[model samples]
Target: MLKQKSGPSRRKVILIGLDSAPPELLLERFLDKMPTIRRLVKNGISGRMRSCDPPITVPAWMVMMTGMDPGQLGIYGFRNRKGWSYSDYYLTTSTMIKEKPIWEIIAQTAGMKSCLIGVPPSYPVRPIMGNLISCFLTPGLEKEYTYPHELRDEVAEIVGEYEFDAAFRSDNRDEILEAIRRMTNKRFDLANYMIEQKEWSFFMLVEIGLDRLHHTFWKYFDDTHPRFESGNRFEMVLEDYYILLDKRIGELIENCGEDTIIIIASDHGSKAMKGAFCINEWLIREGYLKLAERPEGIVSIEDASVDWDKTKAWGWGGYYSRIFFNVKGREDKGILTKEPGGDLDELVTELKEKITRLVDNRGVPMKNTVFSPDELYKTVRGDPPDLMVYLDDLNWRAAGTIGHGKIYLEENDTGPDDSVHSMDGVFILYDPRERIRKDIGTMSIMDAAPTILRRIGLSIPKEMIGKPV
Candidate 1:
């Protein structure tokens, strides 16, 4: 167990997690429109917070809360390999997280109560010292979503059948827009109610609507998007949503009172997606992955008949690519050996070189980055991919489907996504008692937990890698 010390003073902390909020949009472009956020930045310390590698939501949010990197957490993405098996995998849940989060730590050390809402992988709600509500990852309302069980009834009374997530990937923009608004409004309503009704020293709520908005309506507002056009029907949609968000934030702050410490943060940033790179197709063409028979149309790699005996590697796709090597003694029908100066090592080297030097559709060099799990994290814990790839610095998502007959695609393979997650998210920390309008510049996402712990009069855990800001 980690040791803790008591301090002379303790203050309430409110963490507003805005999923996929970028520094460029929140801090620069839309700052003037969000009066609440603008005032927070003006009175507090703000900066570009660097998100974790593979910068996706599940691991990123957990990373921020636990003060651990993805590798240390053993969670690379939403779905992870169960073992070395070809197909066995599991969706991450609260049960998988062994590391203690800030709430649990504070509850144990300082005896502080917490009211948490919508923190990722918080489904299958676990017991805490105070109130809790599950995140968007919750399957449905039928399952218990609150820590105390009865808290679910209170939530339902305030917002009928709580909206966990919005289907923003749909082509029906109007429907999705309405769904996003409804979800955001209901969530904020619940948050305000929790603030007034619950007794707690720490409160954290993550809003997933901003991420949905970016992915669904990015092209309409961002002139730089490849598919962008002037005066699109949804051009003002994003701006309007941000303003609404600001209004809700204002209310949330009002409920917290003037002495509370406020923090606005994002797990990862967002950006206009350039395109999708058909990673499976590229691997097949490069002779790393072998298909027994050609897919007649675009099909998931899982559905295709892969000749494992002849396949050296294959890849799964998302905002980044997770490439796995079929190694001897590690996988069934394994071909490559893991010995030093052997086939596996040589193949990894070759793939990294070729992938980094890849060019885009226009034959222009893409600034791709590749990493091994050991290279990115202090401790490699989970069944990590053989190689993690970021195409064109994450502007281009990786498509896991095959039979496209080409490597480049103009849209996301799974849905109509318009934006990709970026590296630099936004963060603003405000203390009502102090008006330090300081620009802290860049901070790591890992720094958030320790910073909060330090500010709230708790000693930082020795295992935590980040220093308090």
Candidate 2:
């Protein structure tokens, strides 16, 4: 285990997580506008941190904080399958996270306290050594959103009716922009208050507004987007928001004092969504999945009348595709054999070959990538999909809806979304006392937990796959 040099005083670490922040945006394009972040980069180590495979928000953030892979955590995305039941799925929550996060480990080993806010899967708030505020996943203010129960009242007293997230998918751009600003302002105000009032050895807060903004306004800002309009009304929206975020970050830095080590990170990056790949439609075309009758309009796979007895495989879609096989003795309407040399293996191989060679709407061969659960992680757990697929290097989202009559969609099936998640996110580690001015290049998302533990003078746990950077 790597260790930090022993200092005279106890070290405190503060992490500001900007969801869906990309190196292309934060570290390059808007770096000049973000003075505070730029200053940190000049003084410390900053780089493109490679996010995990199938990088969705929930599992990515959790993976960074726990030094574990999605496989080890048994969390694939925001929603996961409950078991072999075809339509039974569960949204990921704090109750599902079994691994000890960095804050929990510090609280257990060093008796250190942490102040956490808006960490994903942090809903249904559990008791911790210090203060806690739930993430966007929280149902509403009616539910207990803070740890210690009473912290909720204090939070309400400060930022009345705290905004967990914005309705970014709405068609009204102006309303969404205002809502995002309000949510961000309230979150940062609460964060500054916690910095002043809470006793914490570790502090972390994830601002989800950035992610929302990216998904909503990406097409307006990015000229490379297929739908980009040169003089769009919201063209400068992202720049203004980044500047506002920088100002908020400056405030947090001012409140945390010089002794604190500040780290800015993101779970995953954002990029212009090329389009949506109708995964289920493609499956139907390939004869892997069969429906009782084709729907007249677009509908979710779950709602569609599927011919399960004839279906060999089906898929769920989001940033990536989760394909499940109807294997014998596993699924309710099992068809394929599970044996190594059986029909299941043969089908999987065939699907892999065909899916990877699939072409886009323009008849151009797509750069599709596929992975099996067993091959992707150290230990596969939970009701994992038979295959995890990244469509066209993640530029195209996997659309689960069917009855579109075509495979490619210009817009999201669920809602309006301009951007998709990418593999490279930004990471900046700044220690005011030590102006190292070193560029560490690319680091793994899992390295964050061990690195934080090492900096705080704690032994790295054996289970952590990443070494301290």
Candidate 3:
């Protein structure tokens, strides 16, 4: 255990998380457009922040807050395996986070107050040292979205209803953009109000509009995009949204006191998506997955016609792929055992080799990277997949839905999502109180928790894997 100092700490810290913000897009491409970030970079440190393996939102953010890997935290992605079944999955929530977040540690050890807003996995809001507002996982505003139940109505009245996230996948581009603007404006307004009215040592806020615009309009902006169109009407949509976000960030920076340490970071970055690689399609072709009968139309992997008894392995898809085996005694209807050569270990090795050799329609190898639990994780817990994979460095996503004719799907099953999560996020740390180091070559998302704790003069527990950067 790490001990805390007795006296009151004068230093304050403010952290702003820009969801899915890439350094290439912001720091290089649109740096001139973002005056606030440019100013921060002039005096502070900026670098490429390396995201976790399979850099999806849920695990990435949790890793940043807890300084723990997904294996240790028992969270892999937005959806996790519910049981020993082949297909069942449950959405991750605040309850799923077993590790104590940095905010709780700060409050417990140093008796410091923290105001956290729109941080994911913070739904079903609990009592924090200061105020709390739940993240995108919140079911609805009608339900309790605030720490103090009464704060919900007060926030709504002051900021005109909290916006969890925008429906960017909808076909109505105009309506989607309008909703995004409204949501972003209200979020900043609420954040400004909270900073002014509330008393706190650490304040953190996460904005999701950037993630929404990247998903909805990256194709319109990127010339190398597979589905790119020249001179498209929405080509400037993503860039314009960033400009708007930068202005609000500037306002927030101006409002903060000089003693405060400001850190702007992202869970992961975004890149133009190539397409979806159907993981289930590959499993079916390889005879690992068994279907009851030949189907003419598209069907979910969980279809009743599927035979679970004969199935040896299956995959769940998202920004990355999670492969599971029906090991005997582990799964209820498992057929294979860990006996001799023909067992769970052998099956995993065979599948990994076969999947990495997969080629696209043009005969170019997919060059997928795969990781087993023992290979990637420090401490394993819960129902982790037998194999975790990233296809084409996450430029191409994975999909489990069968009946897509071939292995590749041109569009997302959800709708028109143009971007996929990337490993290179942005990190900018500015502290006016002290002269910090000039440049940090690369930083990990896991470095955030310990670093923040140190900034606010709190102890970093021995259990945390990350050291202050």
Model 3 stretches astray by more than 4 angstroms: 1-9, 435-437
Q: In candidate 2, how many Å is residue 209 off? A: 0.0
Which candidate, 1 or 3, would have the higher lDDT against the true structure? 1
**Over all chains combined, what TM-score does candidate 1 have?**
0.98
TM-score of each: 0.98, 0.98, 0.96
lDDT for predicted candidate 3 compared with the true structure = 0.84
Worst 10 residues of 1 by lDDT: 2-11
* Off by more than 4 A, model 1: 1-8
lDDT of 3 by residue, 1-469 (tens): 8544225564788889999999888788998999888878777888888888658788888889999888898888888888786567888888878898888887888777888899988887878888999998888988789987777776988798789989888788888888888999999999998888877888899998889988888889899999999999998988888899899988887788777888899999999999999888888888988888756787777762567789898887789998888778888878888887777778878888987887876788887899997788799887788899899888788887888768888888767899999998988889886645467878888888998888777778888888888
lDDT against the true structure, per candidate, is: 0.93, 0.92, 0.84
Count clashing residue pairs per candidate.
0, 0, 0
Clashes of 1: 0
- lDDT: worst 10-residue window of model 2: 1-10
Question: Over 4 Å off in model 2, which ranges?
Answer: 1-9
